[model samples]
Target: MSALLRKIMNFGPAFFAIGYTIGTGSVTSMIVAGSTYGMQLLWVLFLSCLFSGALIYAYGNFAIVTGQTALYSFKKHLRFGKPIALMIIVGVTFGQWNSLIGILGISSNIIFEMISLYVPSAAEHKYEIVLAIAVVIIGTMYSILLIGKYSLFEKILVMFVSCMGISFVLSLLVVHPMPAEVAAGFIPKIPEIAGGKMMVAAFVGTTMAAATFLSRPLFIQGKGWTMKNRAQQRKDAIVAAVLVFVISGSVMAVAHGALYHEGKRITHVLDMVNALEPIAGKAALTVFFFGTLAAGLSSVFPCMLIAPLLIEDYRSGQLDTNSKQFRIITGFAALLALAIPIFGFNPVKGQILTQVFNVFVLPLVIVGILFIINNRKLMKDYAAGKTLNIILGFALLFAIAISVNGVIALAGQF
Candidate 1:
């Protein structure tokens, strides 16, 4: 039992990567994509994960080689390094905090929905109920942040990711997509439908999240790994990317099977539950919300940390979670996230802005690591080889193409 437990725990950093990437943003985007286009965008999801694996390995290897975090390495090594690193720090931090607002709002709404399932009249007190629930949830996550230990973070994320992945996989089983349609999704063709372009960009934007790659080094450092653990790090990246594909695909599959076939559309995240109850029974509702909660909390924990993590990474190669900066930043993020639920603002709008902004930074992030990893001085003898370079070159082109079209699609909405 102990040996088996150790094996699960060994994928600690992978869980951190997976936990943060496969959150509310990914779930909402997948639901919309699945319901709207019925698995046509699986190609985008697949490519995102494929490149994400390459970027993860690149960023992580750079950190291991330099014995420094990502932003710091860029600051010290590249031309205009300081400004570039600072831009990433600002861009990624802003995007993550914005994501927190949406994550908290969705999580609390789901809780209220679950409560109302039993106490139907709970709908009458929706505002106060959601606010109170948000407080409790945010407070618990803040308390976890205050604990300030990487092991604690890793363990909690493991539980959340496991719960979320298992629950979603079970839900997919309850309402699986057609096997041929699932296979066809991988053949690379976008539907010529109205929202196809936007959903494609969103799938890429959310799954290939900037926070995921930017934050990888810190998580890797937290685990005390270095170049000697190269093999393990490679294994971990693969594990993380594969899990993102499986879990996110399961979500898309569920929406496709449960809602698409019935010609139902889910406009809001809560609509997922409303749409499910009639077809899949209350048991499925409980499981889906449970997974959503896990996804939300897992994401919220990382969003709260990203600000401090990036700032510390920029200031120095080392992380000081016990520092005053960590406390102040995380506290501010928690309170700001609660505001979305408290004021009843549209988190979807904020998330849309965040997603679009992320696409812009995606190319920059890929460019930075590409230059940094191939530098012999910084990497000494272990600069990246030709094969990895080819993969990143393609990833960069993909990011730029997505960025151009994503902005246009988003602009077209208004």
Candidate 2:
């Protein structure tokens, strides 16, 4: 590739952000929200992505200006920040591990479904097919991270995002949802279902994920973005936020139009895939699965990276994909996730666990960023201004509210 082409191909930090946020967590949350409540909660979806974007900017801008990763800043500034940062690492790592099962499970299921479209016999060996697909997907991710540089990972994720974006948008076109209903979905109204409150919290938590913010600084630093790249970082952040909104909204639109109107239910993630058979035909079913597969793989790659990156941040270590410690940590996460297929873990329970941990972690992370940005000594002239503080304040409140709701939901389960 030429220099110009390579520069364009490199994309930016936002691409990684998009790749991380638009994964299985976003997909599963959107699917549940759309299927169960129709578009009554679309307003929340919009807000989640918007708030997430703002937080990404706040976090990304901090890293760019200070030349420090988030965890390091936390450790340096606040007295108790080290423990909090460690907590974030453990919470995010464990949460993503639980999420890995569902992500990999859903991804493998879609691949199985796509193949089963032609090979009817493939239907009988569902477990084996899922295992094969999971192995291949995780194996490829391990190889990439092991042999490739951050640039290679970014390039591959860009392709994954593109594939998911195109497939989802095209599938939405086939669904041909009503414009007025979609518009009205923007009007805020809470659902009164069984898990309505938790679902709403899940929607918000999943979109504005804790791991995404925690991972931002490392990704930006990897790209060599410093204070000089602030303008480009802002531009990249905006574009990434928009892509997050579009991809997530497209999936919800397809689900609401196809599943909700038909009074269908989503008992399993794969159920959504099979449900697509009649609404948009086999071609769309294939398209949706491929899109889902792309989303899954995109997410799995970053989900695996979090543990190692967290360790890097905690130790203030250099990036070393070939390091023994890094490989062991990453490998542990990958292996743990693979157990989902081996034991046939419950996807719903895994999702609930992931969301609960996410809600619990969200507020702490927002506060960490808030503290970093508000620290005059640390941020100096780059400290968050009034307008930005107001945005973060709302986000902080939102996260707290969601966390509370999640707690109540968990308590009720007991």
Candidate 3:
């Protein structure tokens, strides 16, 4: 194989990170932010990606140096380790599974919208049709999990992620937003409008995702990285963080160009498609929805894998694809994910709300990693240096601050 191909293959962890991080939740939050607040929240996206990169480096480094999974290390090495690890598993699983509900729901709704566009009469029996579509999506995604190895399965998700990134990038090029306003968005002020604080929280929630970092060690382990591949892991983390910012930023830009300037907001999933139509032309619906669907599916698969993946991490560092615990837990997750689609509610609000809720659980994730990565015995020379320590400190503080805002925003909504 060529050197380029080899380099690409080595960035497996980063590819999975892009596929996980830029999924439906991030896409949805970006769309909402851009269409609703124009470019004002790019600061949140920028900071999240920066911190996410640092945390990914920290977690992947600890895993490679110590040769163990995160929860397993937590259980074995800390005071009250078992309970703490179990609580993380529970907290992360709850946030992730709740995300799946919105993910599957949004995916089903988008699919149904696409079908209705081409086959106008299909809207008559929306419930039955959407329910069937949701089941098929769940089944196909779950079956993909049984594909035997992490490497092979992640490759399939790479296709979905590719489609997602390309569509938005192309749209942004076609109907670009103003560079001045886009530049202004990075100045770091949250909008004072209703849900503005919550939108900031959701943006952080999706970009600096808890699952993305919490599961980083397992993903690194699955990719077979060890101490020898330290440089490769850092480069891969950078690759993942850059792709996340670029793709997600493209989505936000496309939405701002198409909708925000016109004072239209994305109240529905298809509103994005409709907004893009006038600016990017008739292909807008097909192109943007294709990207959105890919984004949604990208997140769905990861959500299915996380609970079981973390559970196994807590039990032992080893991940057996064939284990009964993996199968049973994932199957239950896929089944429960159907609730949103079956109930037939519009999921955009729920999706954003879930993303905001994810913010509250993030501080604990960083706290756990902080303890382990700083342990001199466990990390040795790989222990976080001053730079990484400072980044993680800000990351923890950022998580806590947004989480408080998320709670306030959530309370007002109620």
Return the TM-score for each candidate structure: 0.97, 0.95, 0.96
Q: How many backbone clashes does candidate 3 have?
A: 0
Q: Which of candidates 2 and 3 reaches a greater lDDT?
A: 3
By the TM-score metric, which is better: model 1 or model 3?
1
lDDT of 2 by residue, 99-156 (tens): 7877887777777768888888988998988898888988878877787488888888
**lDDT tens digits, residue span 268-371, model 3:** 77686567766677676678888889988888878888888888888877778778888888899999999987776778888888888777768878888899
Candidate 1 accuracy as TM-score:
0.97
Better of 2 and 3 by TM-score: 3
Top candidate (TM-score): 1
For residue 388, what is the lDDT in candidate 3? 85
Q: Candidate 1's residue-wise lDDT over 1-414, tens digit each?
A: 889879989889899888778888788888877887898889899999999999988888877878877888888888998988888888888778878888998889889889988899999999999999999999999988898999999999998999999999999989889999999999888789877777778778788888888888988889999778888989999999999999999999999998888888866656887888987899887998899889988998888999889888888778777888799889999899987887887655455555666677888899889999999988888899999999999999999999888888888889
Q: Give the TM-score of candidate 2.
A: 0.95
**Any runs in candidate 1 off by more than 4 Å, and if so which?**
346-353
Evaluate all candidate structures by whole-model CA lDDT and list the values in order. Answer: 0.86, 0.80, 0.85
Off by over 4 Å in 3: 1-6
